[model samples]
Target: MSQQDPSAAPHDDRPRGDPWHAFGYVVSGVAFYGFLGWLLDRWLGTDYIVAIGIIFGAGLGIYLTFSRFNRALPPDSSHDQHEQN
Candidate 1:
């Protein structure tokens, strides 16, 4: 008699997605930094800095993604700490 669709996800309490967010962070970071690096290279007439910028961007993006998604578990209550087995 269950009305729920069996083919759908079983849990309705699932949290929001992170894959797209992570992808966006990385792609945007690389693109934005790449552009800046390209501009800087043109201005300074350098050849290797663009690679550095891309690398930096990717690293920053990964850091951001992790920082955004990581969750700390809630601390146990004092009542629980004193509970008997």
Candidate 2:
């Protein structure tokens, strides 16, 4: 067996997970919030303005969620290392 170098940087072995999970969660969350807002507005009979606000809030939540996953890198970056050189 070949000896391993302790000084070398450790390699990542697991498959790189997608960063889009958060985005999906955000989208679902927004849809849920929007529905709630619409229900509340309809029940209170204050017009649809509150519903619109709820939609905007949902959009914001989606954006933030997607942003969180925007920086995700692949599990194996050997290709990246080669490209960098």
Candidate 3:
């Protein structure tokens, strides 16, 4: 058996670090909200709710995408600062 290094971080094998993930999130958001709006419209006899829901879903998706992808990360102390001895 090989020994593992305790200081090494574990590798992530998932493929979520891509732009497609954001696109999927946006599309799914829009579809889900649009479906909900369609149901509400059918129940309440409104014709414009689906459009409004689609727009709202798009806005929400954009906000979520930006929040997840455009976040400002803190400076890395290991590389940005030198240790003072």
**Per-model C-alpha RMSD:** 6.6, 6.4, 5.1
Candidate 2 residue-wise lDDT, 20-85, digit = tens: 665565677667777777787888887675567667767777676656645555666665697889
Assess the local accuracy of residue 55 in candidate 3 as a C-alpha lDDT between 0 and 100.
88
Best candidate, TM-score? 3
> What TM-score do all the candidates reach, one by one?
0.67, 0.43, 0.71
Instruction: Tell me the number of clashing residue pairs for each predicted model.
Output: 0, 0, 0
Q: For residue 24, give model 2's deviation from the true position in Å.
A: 2.1
Candidate 1 regions off by >4 Å?
1-15, 73-85
Prediction 3 global C-alpha lDDT: 0.78
Candidate 2, poorest ten consecutive residues by summed lDDT? 10-19
Error of 1 at 72 (Å): 1.8
Candidate 3 is scored at a TM of 0.71
lDDT of 1 by residue, 1-85 (tens): 8797776533333335659999999998999998899999999999887888899899999998887777554555643666843
Question: How accurate locally, in lDDT, is each candidate?
Answer: 0.79, 0.67, 0.78
